[model samples]
Target: MLLKRLIVCLDVRSKRVTKGIKFKGNVDVGDPVEMAERYCNDGADEIVFYDITASAEKRPIDIEMVAAAARRVFVPFTVGGGLRNVVDMRHALLAGADKVSLNSLAVEQPDILHAGALAFGRQCIVLGMDARRVGKSLHFPSGYEVVTHGGRCPTGLDAVEWGRRAEALGAGEICLNAIDTDGMRTGYELEITRKIADAVGIPVIASGGAGTVEHIADAFSTATADAALIASMVHSGEYTCSGIKKELAEKYHLPVRLTSN
Candidate 1:
């Protein structure tokens, strides 16, 4: 069995790690570089840094911050937000991000996905999808629409169809974040997660609404997700990455990398 991964996400705005509910009322949490190092030490498998305002502000990502976090962590790190083209992707990688996640830009110009994959290899390209449940329509048969600009804009694209297209365009992985459940910590939107996971061959990382250990296990087993992206639970100092991994191994019988007790 493949070992399920536990990834910690740091949503940065104005260079500080922040957390919000449904992408609104965001408040600064701490320094992102310090938080990344803390999570890495807590045994997180990977770290995802999203410059939450970069795309909306129409500016470049904080490459210096990415480099600072990369210097502090030993594990793989993914960076996203404000990355528009192949040149931006290359700069992110050069600044120490193992992968570059594309969302709004990918939706606007899909060919960038093909270009980035060809230029940097598919493994370095991650598709960050922010999806919200919408009423069923001809355009959105799945009733899930892709949202961008930090969940402020909605594109009529169906979430599952977008996942398929991203995979076809050479995205090595997809991070599916549910707008409704973000920071709520109730659980993942299993339906949409499973839908995208089943529709795409690449690994799907379920994001948003991971409140408890059970929720994490459900994402892996019920949703069939390859990884879980956590923010509030870890960011609020309520749970540790090692603790979650232990629960998954002992209670859920899920394959996870356990640390020495």
Candidate 2:
């Protein structure tokens, strides 16, 4: 069986890792490169870095920081935020990113998903979809609206529809984040997570609102996600990747990758 993945997400701003609730009021947590190295050794199946302010600032992600992480950590890591085109994605991959994620830019120019996947292969391209619970509308029957610019802009696109489109465009994975539950530590937004997961064949990584190990277990079971993206829980030092995997394996009897630990 393919073991379920536990991913640690580091939202970066000004070269430092930051945490925020609903993508607002962010505070510096640590150095991005340093934190990534710690998580790599501490048993994160994969690590994801988001240049949290890059899209809002209209600048590309910090390639220097990505290179620094590449040198320090020996694990598969993904880099996202403000990637404008294929050239930008190439730069990140050359700098040692196992994968490059696209969010706002992908929604704005979906062809980039096709282009990135064509140039780097589908496995190298990930779509990080940040969505909000806007209730159901005629346009968004799924009750989840796709939001961009770190949840500042509502695109009027249904989350599940976008997931299906991204998959058809050659995206290898979808990192579905629920803006409403982000940093709340309540639990993952399973409804949207499952909807997107079911709507697409590509692997779905359930993100946002992971407070307890039980929440993580719920993601793999009820949500049927291939991976769980953790932030506040591990970012606050309240949990470790190894510890979470242990709990998921032993207590929940979930198929987690404990071998790496």
Candidate 3:
């Protein structure tokens, strides 16, 4: 198996790193640059910054914040939200994001994914899928629906099929966030996660609901996720990137990357 990654997520709202439960009731957490630097220094394999309200508000991502984070964070950094076109994506990459995540824009205009990949190569194109479990239905046979605009709008697209479409459309990766379990501190939605992971040939980063070392372990072992996205656990000071790595390595015997370099 490939070495599983431990990625730290920072949701930026009004320049501050904020987090919420199931995409609601968000509260300010900290500065994006400082928190990102801190986590990077703590040995995070990658750092993802989401301009949470950009798409909902119909604006652009904070490019300045992306540049600031790039100055401090050394690892691979991905930025998402409010990227509308190839020009916006170009600005973000120029601003120092290693990858640009496409959620709302990609859902509404999937050709942007092809355009982005054509311009920057597939490695820089990441499809961010905000999936919520609505149970098995005729439309969502996988029982998971993709939500957009910060989870306020349901796209009526099945999460599994979306993953497959994204992969075919030149997306190098998929960050699958299960809205039902986001910030719940329980665990990843293994069912949907596994389904998407199985459907996609690209890397699937299982996001949301990371609470414990065991939860992260379950994501890799059971859900078959290539990477795990963590927020509440590390942001709350309950777990550090180093400690999580140690636990996953020693106890669960998972192949977590042990070095920052």
Runs of candidate 2 with Cα error greater than 4 angstroms are 259-261
RMSD of model 3 against the true structure? 1.4
- Across 22-123, the per-residue lDDT of candidate 1 in tens digits comes to 989998899999999888888899999999888778899999998887789889999998897888888999988999999888999998889999998999
- Computed on alpha carbons, the lDDT of every model, listed in order, comes to 0.92, 0.92, 0.92
State how far residue 88 of model 3 sits from its true place (Å). Answer: 0.5
Q: Can you give the TM-score per candidate against the true fold?
A: 0.97, 0.97, 0.97
Report the lDDT tens digits of candidate 2 across residue range 85-163.
Answer: 9999999999999999998889999999999999999999999999999889899989999998778899989999999
TM-score of candidate 2 against the unseen true structure: 0.97
Q: Which lDDT tens digits does candidate 3 get at residues 146-252?
A: 99875789999999998899899999999999888999999999999899889878999999899999999999999999999999999899889999998999999
Off by over 4 Å in 3: none
Higher-ranked by TM-score: 2 or 3? 2
The residue pairs that clash in candidate 1, if any, are: none
